[model samples]
Target: MTKFLKTSLGLVAATSLLFSCNEFKVTQETDGSKFQIHEKGDGKTTAKEGDIVTFDLVIKAPNDTVFTDTYKRKEPIVMPVQKGAFKGSFDNALTHLSAGDSATVYVSADSLFMRVQQPLPPGVTKGSDMKFIVKIKSIQTMAEFQKAQEEKKNNEAKVMENYAQKNFPNATKTQYGMYRVVLKEGSGATITAGKSVKVDYTGKLINGTTFDSSVGREPIEFSVGQGAVIPGWEQALMMMKKGEKSIFFIPSNLAYGEQGSGPIPPFSPLIFEMEVIDVK
Candidate 1:
């Protein structure tokens, strides 16, 4: 989101002073912009405009409260450099940093708030100086990133296939790669496209972490062949009949694909224990 982009530029300010410490030299620019270099890094290449920079960050407010910390997630945040639009002193700082560089920068919250329309936290005053401790995890051009992502996805698919063979060898797979195991046969009405089906379901990631369920809540009803649910769910519901129960192992592509929903990561396989309560 743009909030990430704006927060990335919190180090931008217009003017300069210099200070030195045993570990690193700090260059203080006008309006509370401070850049400290910890390691220049051994990588020959530096991040350029349009390149995606992946970094770990921790942002804290003046009240000593944490605002955002990607380190806690154990995943680095990736942001593309857009030079012409939101170009700032931080972008310039990135050009000097290479992969593996670790540094700290300080910027005036007042100056940052002026550039972007954001409400300050209750404890943060107008002129509070925000601190950013960042470590450059990696840098990649858009093309390179895309290629890596494709390779990763293909590897995940292979793992998913192996998992299915081991856990549900008797299950049948659809053309789109969703594997299904029918637990109970239904003698009631058959499900079809354009019919409304009510279902009780529990969904989880391949790692056994439950993401959602309708165990306590009432069963949900939605029309089939509509974009109301994920493609895998829609497809599986169409093959089921009233009172039928089944388990579906959905590949990432048929489920959430590259863009996962809330609490889900990109390219994650899913498991759904489903029951068709009624069909109309």
Candidate 2:
């Protein structure tokens, strides 16, 4: 189910048994859990709670319908292990795996959908098995993963700084840390909190890829300072006057932060070219 894509519990993998690449093996434990290992690792490595693991996972239902696949999403699932957060046999199978290991853990479709509070689809029944093919890529302590994450954020910030300096030489940073460049000044009323305003705008990422726009459609109207938009738009719009045109370089903290919205990846900086069409 698509709900699995947005859940923290779905990131966990359960541990089970061992098998060889040359032969297919299926084992059903006394507890009614089943698993099949396609390829075994060297067995020198293992993971536990609080450790971070990176892996590619694909969930398949009957008829070869894929529920979700991290490989096709272009982003492998990297997450901290939190046991008992989810109610399923899948994660129990992960404890037996190490880096370079791959396996298919099976769970009853009824158990999974019931845990997520969803009804099973037509092709799946109560006792039907939902298969998860998981390939463990890497494992690290939480401290190591945190350090890597911080380094990644710093690198992205540096890239944004270089781009802003090279392309917007005259841009001024605001007191709240937003970089701004006014293109056209207006003599109309100043925009303020609680004021209703209408604007046409184009939004892009740091790479100049446009993600959204109001230019070809109707201008959007919203009340200022009402949390009606992203923090970037709310802050930048307050600095503009009616009919003013400006370009803003918003950091991730003021845009989407680490948990990005649709089409926007985590820790992404954004660009916006906007015109304040009216203030009411």
Q: lDDT (CA) for every model shown?
A: 0.77, 0.80
Model 1 TM-score (2 dp): 0.68
Clashes of each: 1, 10
- True-structure lDDT of candidate 2: 0.80
Candidate 1: deviation at residue 125, Å? Answer: 0.8
Backbone clash pairs for candidate 1 read 15-30
Give candidate 2's total backbone clashes. Answer: 10
| Cα-based RMSD of candidate 2 | 11.9
TM-score of 2: 0.65
Q: lDDT at 143 for candidate 2?
A: 90
Q: Give per-residue CA lDDT, model 1, range 20-60, as digits (tens).
A: 34448776654223767777666776888889888887776
What tens-digit string does per-residue lDDT give for candidate 2 at 1-280? 6786646444442111222333467766654547787887766778777788888899998656788897766557877766643445676566666888888888778888888899998677777889989999988898987787677577876877788899998999788667899999966667899999999999887777677899989999999999999999999998899999999998888888877665566788899999998999
Instruction: Give residue 276's error in model 1 in angstroms.
Output: 4.0
